[model samples]
Target: MKITLIIPTYNAGSLWPNVLDAIKQQTIYPDKLIVIDSGSKDETVPLASDLKNISIFNIDSKDFNHGGTRNLAVAKTLDADVIIFLTQDAILADSDAIKNLVYYFSEPLIAAVCGRQLPHKDANP
Candidate 1:
């Protein structure tokens, strides 16, 4: 099954690279990686451009709406059997995190799945 991963980014900040690294190391990678950036003034766009096989779409900052931006990316990924949406700051917890999540779709009754969030090592309890 074709899987597409979409991430909507603005000013993703310094941690964005780490998030992208985690995705690059995933055991089961998506067939397509799309980044919809809304006029970031930082390095978000250039950093994302460094990655190979990534499709980046830029929109005016004024035009961004949380749900609308996601829908915009979805429109371009209509051919994918599975579409995964992630926030810019969310880093996958492990190499198999996505693989584990995607496998659930194999069950005929499973329509959606959510991943558990673990606090970062630097996060205060």
Candidate 2:
């Protein structure tokens, strides 16, 4: 399946690199990576923008919307069998994480899937 990943970010800070690295290590790397940034003052934009497989886009922070911006990113993809959405803070737990996400589409009847999440060690109880 042709899968594309969309990540939306602001001031992603230090966690973003770990997120990117984890993505690169996935057993099934996305065919394309699209990052939508709302004008971050931090290094988040440049960090992802320079990556070989990532395409970064800018929008005014004031114009950010939950569904709207993501829809915009989806519209940019040439074509994809499946589109996976991830936030900058979502670090994949293992290489199989993405592989698993894409696996569902193998079923001819399954058109989409959402991944399960486990709380990070730093989460407050």
Candidate 3:
């Protein structure tokens, strides 16, 4: 089973390093890591390039929306069996998150499943 994890970023900077590290720690690492950046002025490109497992798609446009960038990333992975959409700031809690997601799909009736998201201490309710 091929899983494509798409991360939408814009000036994410060091935040992306943690996210990618978490992905690497996952029990089921993604087949591909696609980053859809909206022309970040920061060192996002260089940072992503340094990572061995990441494949970045820098989306250049005058006006960049999160939804639009996400759509473009999804469009690029047309052949993937499963697409996992994640924000640049989000870090996976457990290594089995990806494995769990794919396991649920073993049931033909289950087309989709969303895991619980715990808010960070700094995050507001």
lDDT values, one for every candidate: 0.90, 0.88, 0.80
Cα lDDT tens digits for candidate 2, 71-125 = 9999989698889999888899899898998888889999779987676777445
Give the per-residue lDDT digits (tens) of candidate 3, residues 7-121. Answer: 8878985666877778888988888879887788987777777665578887675657877778888888888888898877787888888998889888889888887777766
Q: Which residue pairs clash within candidate 1? A: none
lDDT: which candidate is best?
A: 1
82: Cα error in model 3, Å: 0.5
Report how far off residue 94 is in candidate 2 (Å): 0.4
Instruction: For each candidate, give its TM-score against the true structure.
Output: 0.92, 0.92, 0.87
Those runs of model 3 whose alpha carbons end farther than 4 Å from true positions after fitting are none
TM-score of 3: 0.87
Residue runs of model 2 more than 4 Å from their true location after superposition: none
Assess candidate 3 and give its lDDT. Answer: 0.80
Q: Which of the numbered candidates is closest to the native, going by highest TM-score? A: 2
Quote the positional error of residue 81 for candidate 1 in Å.
Answer: 0.8
